[model samples]
Target: MNSSVITPIGKILNARDLGKLVRDLREKQGATQADLANFAQTGQRFIVDLEGGKATVRFDKVLQVLNILGVELTATRRK
Candidate 1:
């Protein structure tokens, strides 16, 4: 996605925003938290925390999850 769309999410805690996005994507893809966790190579509990927006997850971890969900993060200057 473009940086403009991501900028608002970036301003907040990325974990929360990314978590919500992941949850939505997973649900849309008919994947469960456990399934996503396995795909992301993380614990299910972590996925729960992510989905709940209750953790300050690392950016790299968030990116990993997003990658697994086929969501790409991109940046571009806004004019």
Candidate 2:
């Protein structure tokens, strides 16, 4: 059986697409939610909600967490 997990991104209300990106990166680094939460200096529940794509996170907090996870954000103009 091949089953894929679909994370909430563009499908949910106020869903942060970056959450999925963070979750993927964390998995690649073999880091647990608790580890990420500690690294991000946030509550584990917050991390869980973020990873689950169920959190209404603030932009600054999102950036902070991304920075803590060593995830850099780059901007580019549309061609």
What's the true lDDT of residue 12 in model 2? Answer: 24
Local distance difference test, each candidate: 0.78, 0.71
Model 2 spans with C-alpha error above 4 angstroms: 1-16
Residue 52 displacement in candidate 2 (angstroms): 2.2
Query: Which digits, one per residue and each the tens of the lDDT, describe model 2 over residues 6-79?
Result: 33323222455656877887898899988988888888888777877766766676787888876665654556
Give the distance in Å from residue 63's predicted Cα in candidate 2 to where it truly belongs.
Answer: 1.3
Q: Over 4 Å off in model 1, which ranges?
A: 1-15
Name the best candidate (by TM-score).
1
Best by lDDT: 1
Backbone collisions counted per model: 0, 0
- Show the lowest summed lDDT stretch of 10 residues, model 2: 5-14
lDDT of 1 at 75: 64
